[model samples]
Target: MDQPPVPPAPTEQGEPVALSPPLLHAMLEASHCGLVLLDDMARVIYWNPWVVRTSGVALEEARGRRLGEIFPESAGGRLHQAVEESLITGLPAILSPRLNPHPLPLRAYAPDGRGERLFTLMMIKALPVEGGARRTMIQILDISNSVARERQLREQARELRAQAEAIGRLADHDNLTGLANRRLLSELFFKARSRAKRSGRPLAALYLDLDHFKPINDLFGHRIGDLMLVEMAERMKACLRGSDCVARIGGDEFVVLLESLHHEEDAVIGAQKLREAVGAVCRIEGKTLQVGVSIGVALYPRDGEELEMLLRQADAAMYRVKQSGKNGVALTTREEGGWPPFG
Candidate 1:
């Protein structure tokens, strides 16, 4: 909620680290995500407590060993290949290997006794250093559930196009809330901008920042904080039409992209509805938390023609509203500034 809290799944909390190695080790030792650090040569340099828990390996045994040595049963040398390529090519590599590969005729080497079915999908990325070889960070995710769901989804796709939105609920929606995320928002935003340009209708983007969200996380555990986000997404959805796009843009932020609006009032009315809808306090599992939405509105053609331009204006308006107090909307202007935050 406070500027994106770490990476996916859950994490174990510990004390802060400054110039402390013991404290840092303690932190990693406490994390829920299985963390394994590798060197330039793809050798295990550091293995954490979660890794031990998930992998059933001890540090004394794992350290000074290569990944292939430890997981010899894993015929998927895709991780090694990725590392070699990244080292030589100076590029990043991310691969989610298929969980269930077709078994070949030669089955003597079928370790794990599950044929070609992989229990996990390992996501590895090489982070390059300027004067040194890149360090490859590998995160292994259990996707057995996802694999089963995908198979079921493949069969259901033919009849679900009317609401094909059911394809990848976890992929398309925010993890905490069943709301569309930035990935979907980008798709919808571009479509709306295109249609508005062709039909001469005003397109508006509302970038919303949730006020007092971090405080809620601090007061309540992350479990309840996640529930609150889901509740907020539901409330916003109630205020929006099926055609209008509302998406979570990471952390405590959401954007409402209104399309085919002939007048500014249409978008403004939608914004007002969302504002009123999010006004009430939410109670999650005996904890009462209050959060409000700060909206930044930017109109197409009137604001800017480019999608990036419109988004920038909207984002600027959101930050402006945050600066002014909260629970209100602001606009962008050509005379003020433009957003290409990155060159």
Candidate 2:
């Protein structure tokens, strides 16, 4: 076979000789990035081998064609405007990946043919020539790996936020019954008491103890007892308003806070509803089990001013109910020489 002729080397002069067409074409073909040259009319005067390999368009097919004809989606996009601006102003224009990511729908040279090519960052610059003809040079670089890493980081951050929220809930709530624990109940009590004082409304604290809960726990396994406590919490919550607070302070013992109460009678009535709700039969593990709650009511500013004082008074009142009989409500005040029954 005959060998192709090489262009003559320049002498040891000030500037090297201009490259021949074949030499320039060979250099552009060896480039890593996609390179393209467009004339003043935006026609593809030169499309390098890199573009041919990446875009799947041969040089002969791309030559003398407008960019829109090659990539119809790029007709009015940033890539097209960048080329026009560079040619008109004789300056370079950039199409950042953040702003104009994926100007071309070029596919990746994947071995398994599974993945698409990453978005490309492009630059358009004016190419100076001796003939005073306006030409634009376009350069494209792929940035898919960076975008994928950023998305992964965002997903990790979202997971971390969700874990933090769950930790906070666990710290404030009882793990078994999913109700507010002792620590959180104390905080809520003070806040509710302050609001009641400011509004001149009564706040009622009902100290509730599940009657004969230990026998159930001893007869059945602790698992069934745990289920009973969970059911008890749900029924107690159902008997109260949304504004009311319910907390499981300890095993088989819960506290209910009724805020903005109009009268002490309302607290007695609420306690009755709670006792009835809890006394309902529960079928767990194919066995029927029944339970009752002994609730002691204490009104704010009448029973005591401070939370500890009111809690103590309510505890004493609840002891009275337990002494007389279980499954009933008792108020701190004895209006008619006996604690009236609201149930």
Candidate 3:
């Protein structure tokens, strides 16, 4: 298939109806909306200074970036299709109030990933720009102030959704730890197995049970025990990347999914990190309580392709750590002695 011809690189219009980049930049910048100019193929022809200022994506980088590629919410033939309609019809397409779940916020890589919406009053005008027929100017007003207010009302709705989700999750999540219960584990295990098959990637599962947890519960009370779990969760969260999932399978028992592992050594490194984080003393209510975790790791496509086999192997490996002693990471690898002896 022949690729769509690229738009001539944007330049100061010397003659032909005459619109200078400086003047055009000024006009678009002064306007209250984020402005973008695109070719027939949705190739970015001109992304204005205003858009550069707002989105933190520079005009230089914006050139050649497609309407769908620039933003996160542009997945699955969305906003690109909207642009297609405007160009094809040679009519301005306007959305008075934009509606999209996980709407694209103008600024990228902000501290908050689940960012507030950048509700925009979008106006798409099909026009001749550069040298491409597939061309349009998109104007988006940052209606975030209204969006912020709307977010307040939406907070209640979010809370209601959360409450309902919590009820559903309660069936498969540890209430005290807010971690996945055994039931959820089975589902996750199956999914992980499928991921390994589809992606042809190595997957690692770490089964960790905190050492000396019962002593803390006995020494302090169930109340203090609950606080310790919360503290431990925070510590674990600090150690994990966004891709990893940590679930409390049972009391003081946690499971971690180490994704996209390429080698056997990677699993061992993950186990070490878990040891360091959990070994640290947690200070709660002005009292310092120390605990440790014993972790057993099982690799996918190496240990077993099936979920049941891997989980069973991982669990068995975890118990070995407990039986021998505690505070170490064990990987289920036959390279050493196959199933590692307890401890």
Best candidate, TM-score-wise? Answer: 2
**What is the model-wide C-alpha lDDT for candidate 3?**
0.75
- How many residue pairs clash (N, CA or C atoms closer than 3 angstroms) in each of the candidate models, in the order given? 0, 0, 4
lDDT of 3 by residue, 186-252 (tens): 7877787777788887888888888999999999998999899988877887787776778887778
Q: lDDT tens digits, residues 78-123, model 2?
A: 7777788888888788887777768887767766544486578888
By the lDDT metric, which is better: model 2 or model 3?
Answer: 2
Each model's TM-score? 0.49, 0.80, 0.50
TM-score of 3: 0.50
Local accuracy of candidate 1 as per-residue lDDT tens digits, 1-343: 1245333433356544343578667878877555667878778888787566556578889888887788775434666776667656656555563632311111212345334333455556665564775676666555556777888998688567645555576677777777787777778877877777789988888888888889888877788888888898899988876678788877888888888887887777778778878878777887667788888888876877766677777888778888888888776755433533544
RMSD per model, one decimal: 25.3, 7.3, 19.1
Which rank order by lDDT, best down to worst? Answer: 2, 3, 1
Best by lDDT: 2
CA lDDT for candidate 1: 0.71
